[model samples]
Target: MGNEANARQLDHHPMHGVLKMSEFINALQVGEHHQQQTIQAYTEYRFAYRICASQLRPVALLQITYVLEAISSATRPTIILQNRPDVASLFTIDPQTGVVRTVESNLEPGSTHELLVIASDQGLPQPLESTAFLSVTVEKSNELRPQFDIVWLTDNGTPQIYENLTIGYVLARISVRDAKYDSELSMSGCESICMKQTDSSNVYLLIVCGVFDRELKNSYNLLFLLSSDDKVILEHPVHLEILDVNDNPPRFEHSLIRVTFNRSADQFDVPRIVATDADHEGNARIRYSILDTNVFSIEPDTGILRLQKEFDCSAGEVRFRVVAEDGGKPPLMSIVDVIADVIESNAWPPVFTKPLYEVSVKEDAEPGTCLLKYLVSAGLHWINLYPFDPYLDN
Candidate 1:
């Protein structure tokens, strides 16, 4: 009102219609003075994010992307998905776009992952940070098959199983990885051989149903079938190589061996002894040894008994045993009785018909009378002589 009164007073005095005084008065208004205020747009915050876990598969170029969506806010607020140590390995988030993605393809089905999502507005000094909860459910998928570690396979691609194990021994610890929560193992005809499985783990222990003989069967081919609740996953083949154990002992060709040599003849070797073992390869290799080597020594490789030194007829008989040993974890042994005899020498002693002989003449008849005779003893001698004695004494 004061501005209007002043404008009217100035119009009557000077510059009335000369400088467009009506337009100037129209431009001025008399009222309470106020300061201009700026209005900021408001945005409502959201908290929960529910993602279906079943949608994710291992088929991804880099990573399987999941949308981490939020509501639009005033001043173009930026949304971010936060990471936690507990589920850090499972997933990652984009700060600006709010897109959630997986870090690996090994996510378990039917598992829940928790994360924190923050929504902030474009405030000057500090942005208004809002916290929200993010949850993801891993749905079941049949994309991946169970696998066995390369440690289970040998150079020949066969699994190893030790022999001479107790009734129940763990051959291997096989774990089957799957993408479904209801995956199960079908082990048919396993119990017949005493092969059993642990309740909590996929590991199976080899059972010694009966005596294990490498000579009989060295390995067994095992087929395991894996099936999900919906369908059969795969059939795994494992060849178990059963290692050998020293069990069989060596055996001889004869229980008692008789070896004889004539003392009159030159030195000669006894026949080669033959021994055998049920074991295979190195375990079957038998080494020969004699208990008494004084008069007789045996060749280990050939088992031939050679005369080490001379023996006289006085040594009538020499008896010993030859042992055969096989190469095994614990060597097997056997013995064969050896009887060695020496025949008498070729030379013979003299044998006389009488030591003393009494020869009587016919009452002093002829001067030369035939009386007793002396002879050279037994075996064919080079020279033979028989002499007659002329003794008359009784």
Candidate 2:
């Protein structure tokens, strides 16, 4: 019993050479004579396993071997790869050392590899076999920098961003190459009103974050920076022009204009109908005209009004419309009412006054508001007073 216990304990030690039947018996005695003892054991097993590799790169990942109990006369397992026909060409395994390595370095990113590995122990009629699944996942690596393919919306030979576009409106699209890796995008000029959005793995959008006004800012010089793994790889410059929109109509300082002139005056200077448009380019160009062209005419470009012919004084007060139109796709316009009072020179007989009288008034003034008061000499010693009402024609 003692010899059998010692033999079993020795079986736990690593086996180096061949074992004989006589080695198991240290001593066996019966009736003062020595006797022989024999012991028998069997070898069976399981496996060890997994590996990881990077895409497009060669790697010798790990080794695989069968896990066996310490026993005498046990043979080392032979390892072999049993994989599908499609992936059989991609991997290789060493039969003696059980080392696993890649056959080719052309693995795609995000691809997973599953290999069935078999290990057979050398035994009598049929060898003991054990199987293990070696899972190898090709992880994507950040090796290449981000590349950009930009598409611009253009108008009249210029990249366009229409004024007053809503927030989140896409202005341009960019196709990115090698976008699976970690990447960052940044914009320099016009960052406050514009931003970048990732639409897909290889697509990106340039969108508006705020309103745009062509009158305030007509053009933008945008610098796009693309980075990979925190390193800047590309610096691209883009020129964007803000297209004009007819959002602002031609505006007149005063909606009503009043003029008093002497009946005997043949050719008198008429006040210019000043109008302004808060737009860009052709949208801001103003054209002026008088509806009553028989009495007055206006310059198309300068907005200067002038008397073209004589009018009847019996009407007392003559009213006309002055139109201001802008040059845009769909033109915008404004009209102001003009009143001319024909004062009979024979009755008033006023004289001696400055060539021009200028005055300032608030934009929000009420109608019939008295603006300017002037004193005029009726005769050598007599004086007359007149009030200038800016809203007289309202």
Best by lDDT: 2
Worst 10 residues of 2 by lDDT: 5-14
Residues 86-117 of candidate 2: C-alpha lDDT, one tens digit per residue: 99988787675444657766666557666776
Off by over 4 Å in 2: 1-146, 153-158, 164-168, 178-180, 191-202, 228-231, 260-270, 292-294, 312-317, 341-394
Total backbone clashes of candidate 2, pairs 3 or more residues apart or in separate chains: 0
- In the range 165-199, model 1's lDDT, one tens digit per residue, is 66554444556554355666554433324555667
TM-score of 1: 0.42
lDDT of the candidates, in the order given: 0.51, 0.59
In Å, residue 163's CA in model 1 sits off its true spot by 1.8
lDDT of residue 236 for candidate 2: 53
> TM per model?
0.42, 0.44
